[model samples]
Target: MKVLVTGAAGSIGRVVTPGLAERGHTVVGLDRVPQPDGEDGAWYTVDCTDPDAVAAVFDEESLDAVVHLAGHPDEASLPDSLSSHVVTTAALLDAVHEHGVTRFVYASSNHAVGRTPRTDLLTVATRPRPDTFYGVGKVAAEALLSLYADRYGLDAVACRIGSFLERPETLRQLATWLSHGDCVRMVEAALTAPAPGFTVLYGISANTRAWWDLEPGRALGFEPQDDAEAYADSVAPDAPEDVEVDCVGGPFTSTAYERPALDRSS
Candidate 1:
């Protein structure tokens, strides 16, 4: 199948593009940044926020699927994040409808439910209680994906991606980390799921202590391999002695909106 991957130069896209190629799918990578030319697949300089540019690409390629990963991807960056999330999503969904694209795999965020208290019952059906403006935008995109799927018969799947980090070092990430291998599998499932309405799936690995649930995603045939629990011994044994909140999802929930920036590497 011919696949169009937006944000092809970004972190997940860099890994995911080659992964798709290895799976025997012809890939067309689109991004704002200039990447080295690829003979294995094509690359484009289209801006996903522009409806005309996005629509033109769709019209030119008889695309079988679209992995929509083009957007601002920062947690602390406020208005910019909101703008990037909302505009890019709107433009891409509109283009998908215009071009008769069959499947759309959108990159939503765990932050969409960031404000929800960490518990065993963190299902996909959980109502979005966003902790930041970025989270708000992700929730908004999820709604748009659902509406597009219902109205246009597009196969839209929203993956509420958790921390796609290498491994956990802090106490919070031990339960929220989504491994790279697991991310690839989840995206594959989103693209190839047989039955689709507006499915929302958590993008965490097979971690036993994860607060997010994966039963809703089981129907998509995604079975994660890596579990963050493997890093328990190497990571911090307890939450920071001075810190306040202490469930899996991290200080993100109880963090004062104006608190000093915690080092992302921590």
Candidate 2:
């Protein structure tokens, strides 16, 4: 399968781009920044929000799937969040539709359902309770993907990724950390899953204390291999217990997120 990975220069992209190639897929990278040195694969520098530029990439390469990871990585003003996440997603979805791409694997975040209390295990069927403007953008993007899938018969998979890190550093991370190896595995499964139409998956590892259910991902052949429990003794000892323990969104749902919804300064 030929895959196009947006945000190929970012942290997750850096791991996923080459990782996909190692799994027998042809990878074509697209990002706003230039491809880093020593990175192997065909790459294109373009902002995903620009429909024409994104279309040009599709025109040039016959892609089979898209792993969309380009977007604002943190909480921001509502308009900025929408433009970064929703607008970029719309452009790519349009291009995917214009061409004959069959699969769309979005890098949606857990923040989409962050406001949900950590009272029970989270499942894909859980109602969306976005914690911030950034979270709202993710929810909106997922809705758009659903619309395109139903109308166009596309196989769209929204991955609600947890804390993607090299290792667990906090008490929450022990339950939420998505290992680098497992990140690649999750994407591979989503890309290769047979006819998974409009699916929602939690991108996490096989942790012993996971907050989100992994059954949905397993149903799609995403068997996560890593466990964050190994680091529990080390991290849990020093980790601070805070508001994050109250909800699945962690600190994102706290008073700190209550700020201006727009940035007026130029």
The per-model lDDT (C-alpha) reads: 0.80, 0.94
TM-score of each: 0.90, 0.98
> lDDT per residue, candidate 2, 145-224, as tens digits?
99999999999999999999999898888888999999999999999999999999999999999999999999999999
Q: What range of 10 consecutive residues in model 1 has the weakest lDDT sum?
A: 240-249
Question: Between which residue pairs do clashes occur in model 1?
Answer: none
Task: List residue ranges in candidate 2 displaced over 4 A.
Answer: none
lDDT value, residue 122 of candidate 1: 86
Off by over 4 Å in 1: 36-40, 76-79, 239-249, 254-256, 259-266
Clashes of each: 0, 0
Measured by TM-score, the strongest candidate is 2
